[model samples]
Target chain A: MANGSGEVVRNRQVIFRDYVSGSPEETDMEVRESALELRVPEGSNGVLVRNLYLSCDPYMRIRMRKLDVPSYRESFQPGSPIIGYGVARVLESGHPNFKKGDLIWGITGWEEYSLITEPETCFKIEHIDVPLSYYTGLLGMPGMTAYVGFFKVCSPKKGETVFISAASGAVGQLVGQFAKLVGCYVVGSAGSKEKVDLLKNKFGFDDAFNYKEELDLDATLKRYFPEGIDIYFENVGGKMLDAVLLNMKLRGRIAACGMISQYNLEQPEGICNLMNLILKQVRMEGFVVSDYYHLYLKFLETVLPQIKEGKIVYVEDIAKGLENGPAALVGLFSGHNVGKQVIMVSRE
Target chain B: MANGSGEVVRNRQVIFRDYVSGSPEETDMEVRESALELRVPEGSNGVLVRNLYLSCDPYMRIRMRKLDVPSYRESFQPGSPIIGYGVARVLESGHPNFKKGDLIWGITGWEEYSLITEPETCFKIEHIDVPLSYYTGLLGMPGMTAYVGFFKVCSPKKGETVFISAASGAVGQLVGQFAKLVGCYVVGSAGSKEKVDLLKNKFGFDDAFNYKEELDLDATLKRYFPEGIDIYFENVGGKMLDAVLLNMKLRGRIAACGMISQYNLEQPEGICNLMNLILKQVRMEGFVVSDYYHLYLKFLETVLPQIKEGKIVYVEDIAKGLENGPAALVGLFSGHNVGKQVIMVSRE
Candidate 1:
């Protein structure tokens, strides 16, 4: 396949090598060259996208494994281009939902060009006043997840104490902002001092803590949430979740969005204090953003104005080029990057 | 002061010797005598009552231990009269909700006589056609818990598969019946063959299993619930919960009522398959009946008619006297009781 001008160009893709058990490494995926198909196939209902920004989310880690348990989404097939959320510009289309030059964000390959057969899956970028990279972080899947998890699942009440784990990341940062928007007292936990500072200073969290530095998570939770946690937006599960369970107030709600810490582990840790749920009459709910995608338009309406007003902010960590996609994704587990991590594939 | 006739009697009381750890023993409590002044005090809106039926619930075990974590309810005070739910005949009343000879059920001392300052806490028994002991099991706290936990928390729909742990116990029995009432296919797990037989033959469960006899609980659950459990009425929450978590269907709901197994353990068992929640989009919620007391009337309305029509039945394992209350309550831990464990103190 070649460009419309009949000149050959290379498409570099990050391909999954094999299923992994523990922490995934950059070497687990290989950067390979593929035929550049610059145009949508003739008589084919597909949109040819030049991928711009690829999202490096924690959920991707789970996809890299040979999922023995049932999951909302499928694992990445071995020896295939690792699929993830990305921002792209349509170069050609045979689908009615999209056409040439339409900017969109949805599931795409970790590569330069993707022939998206189902263009309807991608949302059209009507509001582009913000940075185009924002589509991969604040305006896309992560944004909607934070929206539904905090507002829909947790069901925030004004003046409630909201605690978000992994609080400096893409979804957590948005949840913290949303909690504050609803007049909640918000606290966050991040892994490093840099991420901790980002949570408190940049995101305006009521309190922030570096979980790694805190020797006693339970005591740390007590310090930040003296009264008790009304809502806990769970990201990193395992011990953090166990500690949070101990701190939850009567009738508290847990929005279990991700269990990143346990995802790569051979065994997910025992969450003791679960009896606290019955004692406090708490509600712990796990949700997937895909289940609530119909509310995307509503979420955009709620978040866009706040983003425009500067009341809500999003910070992104950018990795240049598709060659670095594996490292960018692997970085999420180590907390190497602050805020949302996205790999830059192409300017267009 | 006496029961309207002005006679004083000795009140035999079960007092907590000290805060216990792990499974509570009969020696942890002392059956002693107290002054039985069965009369409402002057200037007090309290009700004086002669206890009749004392309930021996699994939750009583949690109350015996000194809770290191903050709990919704307080632990039993050392050297104080052990409190429990009971049916009583009011000897005197300074509260408008009660009067002499009024039969009521709620929190009471594990003694022959008790002065209840909060008269409003007791529910006045209007229907007495059922065995009076039934008030301690079917018509009282356990009944309400089963009703709220199964119906309110689980939100059952017809044809859903329901599983209950501790199936022959107070709450589990009612949950199974409630599932059947809702047109759900119900399965339950109990410890003994007797209880298992009761669950299937007597209580109309679609199937029942003796969990103690099963080598692999997960396999047993799969055998019972071939499709998958849509609702799990969680009563025993250690290894059983871990197994149930694996067998839950997509969008399944777990109503966490009690964790009798974990309550005694220094460490609650590691619930390994919690990732299944994200995988199946299951919702696990814990509840206390006190929160849903407002629904008691609604529950009774739904249950009483069924009881009258012979569509529902209740079984009570009665401990004949208050002197045996300690053993009766302790028996719950060993799965000795084949049905709802109740201590019969007085018939009237």
Candidate 2:
């Protein structure tokens, strides 16, 4: 149905209900209709964006909680549209830089059409040759996270041994490729055999292992990293983190990206091998990609050409329509999504 | 009781019995009186040194345990004389570098006299105008530890805020002084009120607190470092380390020297604030003083002049004779010492 003021017709979105505890159920979100216009009013200093792809990241799980606990970003409040990074096209803009038909990627709402007032953080997609969907993943937050965490945080040198956890995921896959580009011996661990194969065959990681099959993580790490790990990009925390700590070499560097394992847990497991940090003289650092936004142009310069030349490859797990968005997002916890989990909300 | 022959008396050291669990008792060491000798064997490539002052450190407690825990240095074998850094006068030497009556410091036994075979690790104390006993404390391992851990490891910059734990101990006192020398706003935590005063009065620490008296360590750190901590020299781990982690500023650095609280306990406390590292982009590193041992001569050059001018001060809790050595050594865990704990086996 059309709006009373003669605006284009649109469906109102249902925001996720209050913060979820334990594993989030599909029932957490409720679809509610709203009497709102999708188009920006005349002289309004707002950009009306139609989100094409919404990124489902592990960091979002932290935001769903009530309190700010062990997270870089602020927690999401109840009865609000959960905010995340998304790839959107400007349908109408009252701002100068952004115009109709311009593709932009940055912070947007989880709904179909978002009225963005603070357009300072948004960036126009100058290079449109690549798939527009890549903006949701490989060319966006996940890509930057991999770049900064691996190169800037770890300071990896040539011939250094690198280990990446969740190596077939959006961020982990890019980290593995970056390490390989820098001439590092890279090894990765994934939850399934298919992801393990993807790490080795698709991303070009030196070695890959299915953590599901490996009963002893310590022994598995010892087998892969015989000389010990020089750089560890920690994505999945808990037991994997504990195992990686034991495998770190002298003066090793750890870039703490995300702790996917402990996100759903009531009480995270204790890591005992932390004393090894002192013995090995290791350096452990944790960082957020948002903090390194200033380096976006520099990162683009390094990563863009590689993508154009087919030197860098990316994979995505896309779900069609807003109807399937909830299922696609919830699939992440179970390692159901193969790569970057993206929801295609609309083409318009 | 002098031998008819012109010979030097030597005592074969009492060895600390194989690793003991829990608190070590005097029964752990067996002193064999029959090991005493009155002569230096002819044509031996070894120095007969009369032991003087022996330095006992908390790290020795870890070495005393036979378990194969990861340590920068190897553990002391059971039925072996527990070796520690000590100052002694060489009565006779077959090595050309060390001559008779030359004062030196290196790994030595907890006995009256010992035959030093490997003299390469030992350094001759040429400038012995001051008390030679100082070599076992201020001029020895503990001094190098404070110097390197603060200057080299943490890389403190002027006008930066620095926080140190165990501020009045062997290494912490010197670290505080060094931070003060580098123009850093230095704050320190000690086990007692007296040591806290010593940090402010003697060591020139900018602020001091008795951790035992402070109800909330996080509040104490916040009070001291209103601008937040730029550098944290971690000596005591567990709750103190966790609190420091929370109060760290953006891009802050933490140098982990020791975790005395966790060493004795069977179960170390879990750290829950690691997410702060991610938010602040903080770097936490662990290092051993031995890793930077090559800077010894350079360290002596910088620290000696400071000592001579009384710009750098050192204090020691000395126990006369080997009889009270056990109690003095054990005093570290209980915070019984004011500064460096040194056991005097004999007078020069």
Candidate 3:
């Protein structure tokens, strides 16, 4: 590739077909190739980046739906490249925040090269000793989300009880680890036996259960937390939340992250045990990590050292090429990936 | 009646028949005569008090239901006196906190005399200037509940928008006034037109509506709070809470005081828009005033002046005697009483 107006590359992208219902299938997306220039637009505060790693998250499923009111995220445009968090290298820059050859991570197009007009949204990657893909999981949006949601929103204290749903996924795994670090009694629920074993043996969750296998969520929660739950990191909504309400201790906290189970449903399941909120004096709050993005530098300072010292661990399930992007993105809902789902697009 | 060891008074009492499934009817209770000794029980720390006023509250309805697990308030036992907040005068004392002729307000039996074992629960009434009946409504449990739930739990700020449900009742009316005093734009909803009028015209609420007349609660809330609600003092739950959830602004606070609407339902209404909490970064918390009982002294100091200076006002709907107690207690469920429903058991 040459660094001039004449130089162009075939930028392939996974395009969202249309709005979907139930679970998204791989065929709902189509791979298409478009032309891309190697340089950022002239006289604009934009950075042209070569995309490396793409993050697969449950929240993207919400972005695929049409909303009646203004939401925190916009619906994905039909026949356009799906947008998500990615690690990239700056090929050209018209922005003061970044220089050519600098590595950065932020929201980007699911293509080989992207002209990021919102240059300020991306953060410059300082530490390189760890895998660059770490930005997609441990140091990126999902990691920051788990950190802020647990510590800031939930206000967890040492020796408190913590519960996580979708426990082996990107955010849940880190939350479990973070709760363990804070000396809390952590329990998590996942869909498969492998994920459950991973939570207990690998992630150090005090107890783990397969939600699919459990016939009674309330009884299962009672079995795991005999005293009652103090902090519930809500990832799966519907019946799981209903059970959690009954099992929450007095003055418990619920950090609503994502409701993977109900996002695709035409109408969300009704939460029946809400009156328990009044009985137990519980607080159910929801938060988006973008609100606490200012804490990213501080988060990196704490997490990078832990990662370097082997005090913290992050696992990634990587897909090796751009064509497999659709399957990876759609697979989040089905729990196909073991850990943080990342698609490796290019090499450094 | 003589002042001797065997001397007794005819104690006319209202006794709960059994656990009720629906709204408690007048027939659900039976009035019968029991013997009350003029003196406190010997060899026990009990104070004999002559009952004066009994409070009829929404929480009492919960006590009439059989539960799967033990709740804060136990189910009313068959053939036992209905337990509630009451104003009484100490006839005899085996406890140091009270002596003979001391007027107090606390949990007492619905009969002529009560042997109060836990004297610490009673607060000695110092001033007789205010109506003694106020201890059952404005000066007692409901008043403290409103103060703590609004100021402490809601953490309201001036210029914020506030919405209260069941707005003409004991706690709601006071909360509306408190919001007004704090420079908040307050709107309230009640079941009857008279109650709505009482809220806006008498209680100083900025706006009021009859929820019974409003077909679409969500649309009504939007009309009342065009900019969205910043603080919601939840009293009547079910549909009202569900509507309030949709109208809550970013960083909104919901203080769950009581849920009069859902108390009689076999299965409580499901709250579907809880996901809004995460999208708007809202905090919905449930609390019981007993947790903040330590603030009682401070509450009286703050409220007494307001009442004396005519900065705040309270209304009471009193039934003349213990014979009318069953009707007053049952009337609470039917929205029959105009204000705080109190049974005037005896004159001060």
Candidate 4:
């Protein structure tokens, strides 16, 4: 036993194993226990923080493979901590802007405590009215993503026909609500009946369907959008995108946020009805939410008021403990979670 | 022989054989000759005019099929004359604006003469400074197609990387020049070396390639646009479009004017790399140039100055007589003509 000398630390860290191919296994990551001195180095500009909650996003799957082109984010190095956006509390601060016990949200390591440098992108949480754990989900990157991707990129107009694929996911839920708020006829596709009900009842969508039960997506879209779809927020590609192409209206707009279906395939399926885009005079656009970060202040001004007025409802699937993080992340591929997936590292 | 007063009409018209499949043969069209009155019936507000020059466009191939959704223009009737944009004189006019001896350009019959009503879309031609047949190619629907497709649809910027497929065709030639006129770095792909040279030397493209020589279209586009394409004026779709999708820059725009490569295809080839659009943030829009005819005065405002100052150059391969019209019209698919193919039917 050792007496506390104003430095309390236990270095139990989640370390990545060798790079994975196919489906990821729990054995691919290891949690090792070791000793740590959780004191900030003298004259260091960085902050030492204790990670409270970790976000598990589908894009993290792309980071596992080496890419020829520089993708949205760099691939994770083997045998290193897999970093992502998370909520944390500052244990020790060497920077003037932040102090010990200050709550913040930013890029953090997959461990009990992390030394974070680039504090410019970080935000100190002032309005802690809601659950602090929300920083890992609805109030964080996913919310910003849904906002920017729909409003800015899609350029939605009132009374337009809007369709969203993977409607029960984190980004899709917000997009559907945003579309409804804009006075659009919103229809969404989900994997199960529960998710479909969540979209129609909770999200206030005009119509929702389970794609797993539908034999033909094209016929289903025709039933919903009799005139034709004016906007499509594409989260799942492959056959869904091909079907959407055929149903798009004249001067239609598509915001391609993600392609979850095509990510793990060795050879993705070919899209056949793209020629319909030409025939119908449609506009299809793709974008990343991080690129529009400068619009965050304006977005917050718009979203925060709605949140406070109880206009925008959000849900999260929180997996307790660091040990469950790996499984929670992998579950995203199978559409296991109902909403945003977050792993709670600690209650504080 | 027929005089100006004599009612002499011999209608020999090409008829569309019952909904063709596979590569369309000249045999698929049958010329049937019948006796007809040349004059519009009494009390009818219709103009009877002799057909001069008929225009052949790739979009005609799409009208040959029976689509689930009706196209912008109706499909040709089985035993009727193949209706197309043509140059003709008002031999007899029942409309107030048009009269006998006036030269006009609009949709007309493919045979010797036609009696047409609802001439609202037609316009009387003035200022015959150049060859009258030029109205059939350089100054008529094709010109409007090139102008509106490039400027309005593409939204070209100076020094931007622009690529055009089928660069030597009627519309593509002017699209290349329009891009060059806007100070863009223009590259074009053609079927043969002669057409490629014409695109570079005559139309003033920055680079021109014979696509027949380049086995890999993707590599060819990469070689031309190492930084990625800013705008792609898609004329021939299929493999060319698939390759261009992979080489598009962030926020890149594609104006889908035509898809000649897939016109005759029974089951058109599918594209696999469209998922790249999400990563690159691209915009692909399809348009019909006719929809933007309200901008004709604006188009003339820009084009007239270019022609007057010799800033624009036009090329045409003229067939000497009306008898050569059949051969000249069929020459499009074989890449037989150098530039805009025109036929001289008569002289005023």
Best by lDDT: 3
* DockQ of candidate 3 relative to the true structure: 0.76
Q: lDDT (0-100) at residue A261 of candidate 4?
A: 86
TM-score of each: 0.97, 0.90, 0.96, 0.92
Which residue pairs collide, candidate 3?
Answer: A286-B278
Model 4, residue A269: displacement in angstroms?
A: 1.3
Return the lDDT, model 4, position A53: 92
Candidate 2 per-residue lDDT over residues A1-348, each given as its tens digit:
112243665655647788878887667776555555767766667788888888989888877777643436677756767678888888788788788878899988778788777667887898888988888899999999999898888999999999999888999999999999999999999889899989989999999999989888999999999889999999888888888888889889999888887778766666666777887899898888888889999988998999999899999999987767778778888899999999888876
Model 2 chain B: worst 10 consecutive residues (lDDT sum): B1-10
Candidate 4 chain A weakest lDDT stretch, 10 residues: A1-10
In order, what DockQ does each candidate have?
0.76, 0.55, 0.76, 0.67
C-alpha lDDT of candidate 1 relative to the true structure = 0.88
Q: On TM-score, who's better, 1 or 4?
A: 1
Comparing only chain A of model 2 with the true chain A, what is the TM-score? 0.95
Flag regions of model 2 displaced more than 4 Å: A1-11, A14-16, A33-46, A67-71, A94-97, B1-8, B12-14, B33-48, B67-71, B92-97, B213-228
Q: What DockQ does candidate 1 have relative to the true complex? A: 0.76
lDDT of each: 0.88, 0.83, 0.89, 0.82
Cα misplacement distance, residue B241 of candidate 3 (Å):
1.5
Sorted by lDDT (best first), the order is 3, 1, 2, 4
The segments of candidate 3 whose C-alpha lies over 4 angstroms from its true place after superposition are A1-6, B1-6
